[model samples]
Target chain A: MAEVRLTTPISEEEIRKLKAGDTLYLSGKMFLARDEAHLRAIEMFDEGKELPFDFKGLAVFHCGPIVKQDDTGQWHVVAAGPTTSSRMEIFQDEFIERFRVSVVIGKGGMFERTTAAMKKYGCVYAAFTGGAAVLAADGIKKVEGVEWLDLGTPEALWIFEADNFGPLTIAIDSHGNNLFKDIADIAEKNRPKAYEIIGASKE
Target chain B: MEFAPIIEKVAFNLMKYSATVLPDNAIKAIKTAYEKEKSTTGKAQLGAIIKNFESGAEKSTPMCQDTGIHIYYVEIGADCPIDDLGKFREALTNASRKTTTEVPMRPNAVDPFGSNSGDNTGRYIPWINWEIVSGDKIKITAFPKGGGSENMSTVKMLKPGVGLTGVMKEVVDWMISAGGQPCPPTVVGVAIGGGADIAIKIAKKQLMRPIGEPHPQKEVAEMEQKLLKAINTTGIGPMGLGGNITSLAVHMDYAMRHPASLPMAIAVQCWAARQSAAEISADGKVKYLHHDIKD
Candidate 1:
């Protein structure tokens, strides 16, 4: 679990070396999609419709960002931060396999199904600070464009051309290591102790 | 007489401020936690959060993509016209519409049957609550609550005698179970005394209080401190990566309730639980406030 700098079109060999808790900065292009968009993407895939963007070896951020457009119809990213990943857990494993995304960026961690997918599909789950929207945006070089505007801003698909876009930590890495579960174990051990503090309050 | 224009303008500014600026107290609490955090991941999360606040301010960008739902608390003077309340409400709705575009906020309000406003205005959105004050001035505070934290808010109703200990344990257990989904070191807001719904509303409201600002009641203040300590001890830490400061602060506010029931509510706010306040005088001159910014 060491800090690693990775640029994508990430090869299988590069991802397999990473473990949970490693700091990873991804320099490349990516796009954002939330729960609704994922559902749409899945349905679209099933129906054999044209998807808005190709997903192979790219990063998918779980975000619905605040974006603005100038008079010329160009887009600007006001703030782009990761959403809680667990909300997308249902669609994530399928997304990893169907999209073949090399990196998945979001926060609050994913569960066993996603960990298994990351292992099996050569993907890594990156945790970005949940509310660090503008800091996250600072890493973006351009908003290439957006799609699925019908989904609304918080759920729209915003395709971004980004470079070194992260302070993203690999919370669940390619090898099936899960940072959130490990932390949860420690917290579980401490819970009974914390409950004792509450009981002491009765006195 | 005509306070509509002023209300619209002030509300617009407040929403923008809430989205762009991290209440100074929240920033301070995060900095303090960053210093004391032991886990490298937790510390890095805190550091990224601090950077986010700074960048959001400098760029006047919405801090988090959620931009959450905006909750407004308005204080009005006794002398204000009774007929003007309707005008005030309209202004709130208008201001919310403008802010959605001006702040370039994400369209967050979708109706139950699955239709969004495209702008964030719905009937009750940019929800406003009113309080009557003695003086002839209007004060407004905006809390731009994000979705992630709001999802974790919980309420438990206990038999009246279940007591303070039961409330504390409920909060701790919730925090432990939450395990960073709300984004730690979160601000934990507890509301006790009212019926279940009111308690939940008050708990969400109290999340606006700055970190380290103690509850006014002596006993509640003690409980706040204790709850903060116990929750942190669980090692949920920042983003639940594990560290020393899981919760930056625990705040509680209460309302009188019936003797037979105890309703306790806890609301969690992410570190960027953006809030800002300002006031407009009778003459319609508006002034933004930061005295509540805090240590």
Candidate 2:
């Protein structure tokens, strides 16, 4: 697995070259949004309002982070680990197509529909280590700003300036290889053997 | 005894510490798993997680952004004489509020169909579970349950006849499917033989035990070992990136139930596995447990 460092607004060519199992350390610009922010994004589309920022060739992280404000009122990202992506499976295909996101970073694999979207739309889903919140925050160089404050802190849109922002595993690649799905098949095949080792079975 | 102040201060520190630092056992488990993991992806994943915990402690920042909703297991002494019954509960609420600023906790509490309170508190924030103990001391444990792992927790009612095999199968199946979602290399807690809600509640409580501590019952301890190995062989690995280990430990607690029923609940805690324990004596001397608080 080749480890590559890339900035945001990554090219379609760069995404296409990546494969499942590759490790990536992304830097530069990326955005964070979770369940509610996605709702707001989609709602804006419904109302024909422009999204808060340019979406083409960008990275969107699925996360809700802990950010603290200093006496000078500057915000610091305290913890910023990826949330599970499976919860957003319903919105992802549309999100990818609508936003032209080349990279979607989160943990917990999404389903086949997402895999299809990845293949069809030239996007890739990467798995950031789950619960490595502070580690992820450390890679974030700055908090550019946030959006949708009314949606609460956890659900707001946080844009970050990053440097070596991840040691993310490409769980799903544009080529349609799904590490999450493949692992399940391996586990299923290994199950009966495991059951046998435990002497656990129907009598 | 005048216990309110002690409780409030203890709860506040515990919340901050647990959020920022991985419990000692969790750190050891990750280090051990990193060494044992053979695959490059799995090793790197485990290594990154280990560093994450280290940096969290260094910066005094939360190990995970979620920091999770707070749940406490409190043991109150029956013989202890505290003036106000409500003071303990009030302490929990106040501590939660105070920690929100000091820990700078993200306000995760919401009204479901409504909105967030932004203070991490509302109806039943920092949910507390109480039990009466024989000594004149109160012991409190704080566990932060992240939404990712909490969402994967399961409760099931089996027809008793499926017996042990059925139970084990269901357990392994969930772990396999859950994959990296709940954060693999997880600590699994199983509660067996209780009512529907009791099964789930006790399962969450069972997770409070330190990782790798075996149950006293020989049968249960043996089963825990077997399941731990079983799930690890699935190759879900660290962060589900394909290593040899998927679970650091599997804990199961049993209780009496109706003869025909086998209600089981699976409580999943992510690799962060944050926990803090403290004891307040009747005279009000407080001591912390599980993890250190050195500068």
Candidate 3:
């Protein structure tokens, strides 16, 4: 119900104060990583290798963007939207604990393990509207850097300097509330009536 | 072979147009849903989607980052001068590569050996579904299928006795399981009574039809309406965040079943529903059907 504006390097207290259903407009540095990047980062963590970038206190986007390079060799985000966040469910809990990331932004929400970690680690999950790629790109001020291009463009780790980069809704709050789970519960309860109308029952 | 150049250009435009501009039917449905949506979260999701569409059009960028795998439904006339299907396939593949860099579409085609071709074309890519008819022309529809929604698509075999009711049940279950994953308000395409592969193909093909248009047959049309209603009632809403409009439409097509089999397939098209079409005449002239190409 409240509109909150946050800058990068946000603190646990700021994330903890937000609740499910609140909207956020984020500014400052954010990193984009999806399936391949996540796997690679986790491997680096286990290998005791020096990570290329610091994720602590910043947001990590589950995005694979379409970027182009100019003559000056600077990367530009053309269309950057969230991939499904739930796909990172396996690595997220560990990722949060290790990286100290305060906000996780993506679409379609994450699962129980990630939610529990968010609550335990004082982090929140915000959703950028799914498929709203252009709007998402509009908020990005610059591509600060990129790593893991070897993984391919979409799967690479992109460091973005975001400016008012969201109208993100808090789907999973640090206090254990989850909007997606609530909606799923409602859909499950409503299913039987639809079944009756269609004259079909659970088999 | 005479019309190869025209086919290639038209195919390229189809891919580019579909990436940046949504079809008219899709635009209309989204606007209507926005006006009527009751849930706050649903309204917010739709509002962002609408804004994204405008931004995409203004900037000439792909509407979604996925850009998707390029799939084509091609119909070639029997009397068309391009008698060699290989030439037609080659033309489409070349078009895919052109559009990938020009439209700057994501290089979505990945090799099974763990490498990206770095262009949208690869083995059997720009996957063409071919049909032949009477005219001396070729028409092609480009469908950019996003990964999230494509993952939500399913095919199942049911008992013959389960009938229409069973189909509805499965569709509902699928929608529930899909939740916001496919980026609803999705368009659900269902095909019944074919082999597993055929049913899946027809279900996906049905998605290319204009939204809200009913099937020509009364029985099939009624089934579509019923399925639509049931899906909306699920309260999955936009992005499955809960609302009155979970789906924009439900389209159904069917074929005769084997005596022992009732295979069904459900194809989920995201609300973006990006597709475009073009026709190439025997004389080498190309006409864009669903969208206009700027010179």
Candidate 4:
């Protein structure tokens, strides 16, 4: 797997070259927007309202993070874990197409719609480590701000400036390669042999 | 013997501790998983999970944003003085409030009718399963069930002739198909031979066993090892990045089944398998099992 470092205002072309299993260390601004924020953005697009922020080249993280205040009362993310990425399958394609997002970061594999959209839209889907919220937060230099308080803290949009924010792997690339599907195919081929080994072990 | 009050207190504390501790297990498993994972992608995901758990624990945070449905397995003694289980239920509701705020668990309980409880407790504060035993002590185990892994659990009612081979295929297929959806590396809990509902219950209960522990019965132990190997061989790996180890353990609990049916249930625990227990006596003696909470 190749490792690439990303800075602010990444080009869509750069995202297209990423392949499944390629590691990326992202330093720059990334936006946090879970289901509610996504829906809201879609609503805004439909209503012709001014968007919350510029959407081009933005990386949207699928997360609803837990927040806590420190001894100094500075709010910090306690566990900013990625929610299952597939849950956003219905909206990902449309969201990417409309927003021109350079990257989509979350856990698990995305759907065919997302992968196809990424290929067409010059974007990539990155799989962040599922449970490593603390390590993910360590990459955050500061939280720039937040939006959608009514959506609750978890659903709110958290904007952060990050430094080497990932060891994120590109699960779905612009070339139509999907790491999740590839792995599944390999596993399925070995299923019968796996069963045989299990049988013998049981005996 | 006025068992309602005591039951209430026990259930209440159980719910509170369950929310906080269950994620601890998730964190531990994920960290271990990251270290052992061979897949580059899987290791990356495990690293993220490790960060998530560390942040949750250090910040007194909830491990997953989804705090999950609260499930309790209650083992009540026959000689216990508590006559009414209802009071314990009420106590559980009260405890749920403290847990939501203290553990800062996500408020996941929503009314089926579109009303949000805001607090974790609503129609069912804590889902309860009761086991009446011939004893004087009451023991309760709490599993804070997250939606990701819970969504992956499966149950199948097989004819007796289908036997162990059929069971193995189903379990492995279901999990390998799950890929990274359930957040690997997962702990697989298999409940075999019980009736439909009991089988599912046993599967969930089996997850309470510590990682790497084997079944007491020799045949069952062999089955557990076999399933463990088979699942790992799927190469679903840690976080589905593709690796050598997909599962940390395979735990099974069994009960006698009907002559014609062999029911099997698979309960998958995400890397973050959060669970805790509390045992209370009629004289007010309390023992904390599994998770150790300071203060």
For model 1, the interface Cα RMSD in angstroms equals 1.2
Query: What tens-digit string does per-residue lDDT give for candidate 4 at A60-81?
Result: 8888766665677566665566
Residue ranges of candidate 4 with Cα displaced over 4 Å? A7-9, A36-40, A47-51, A68-76, A141-163, A200-203, B1-59, B83-85, B159-161, B258-262
Q: Order of candidates by TM-score, top first?
A: 3, 2, 1, 4
Q: Rank the candidates by lDDT, best first.
A: 3, 2, 1, 4
The models' CA-based lDDT, in order, is 0.84, 0.86, 0.90, 0.77
Provide the TM-score of chain B versus the true chain B for each model in turn: 0.94, 0.97, 0.97, 0.89
Per-residue lDDT tens digits for candidate 2, residues A67-133, read 8888997888988899999999989988887778989999978889889998988999988988888
Give me the runs in candidate 1 sitting further than 4 Å from their true place. Answer: A200-203, B81-83, B291-295
lDDT at residue A18 of model 4 (Cα atoms): 79
True contacts kept of 3: 0.76
- Candidate 2 lDDT at B25 equals 78
Ranking 2 against 4 by DockQ, winner? 2
TM-score, one value per model: 0.94, 0.97, 0.98, 0.87
Predicted candidate 4 versus true structure: per-residue lDDT over B71-95, tens digit per residue: 7778888887776766776766676
How do these models rank on DockQ, best leading? 3, 2, 1, 4
Expressed as tens digits, the lDDT of each residue in B176-218 for candidate 1 is 8888799888999999987999999999877877687998889
Q: List the residue pairs that clash in candidate 3.
A: none
Candidate 1 displacement at residue B140 in angstroms:
1.2
| lDDT score at residue A111, model 2, on the 0-100 scale | 81
RMSD (Cα, Å) for all candidates, in order, is 2.7, 1.6, 1.3, 3.7
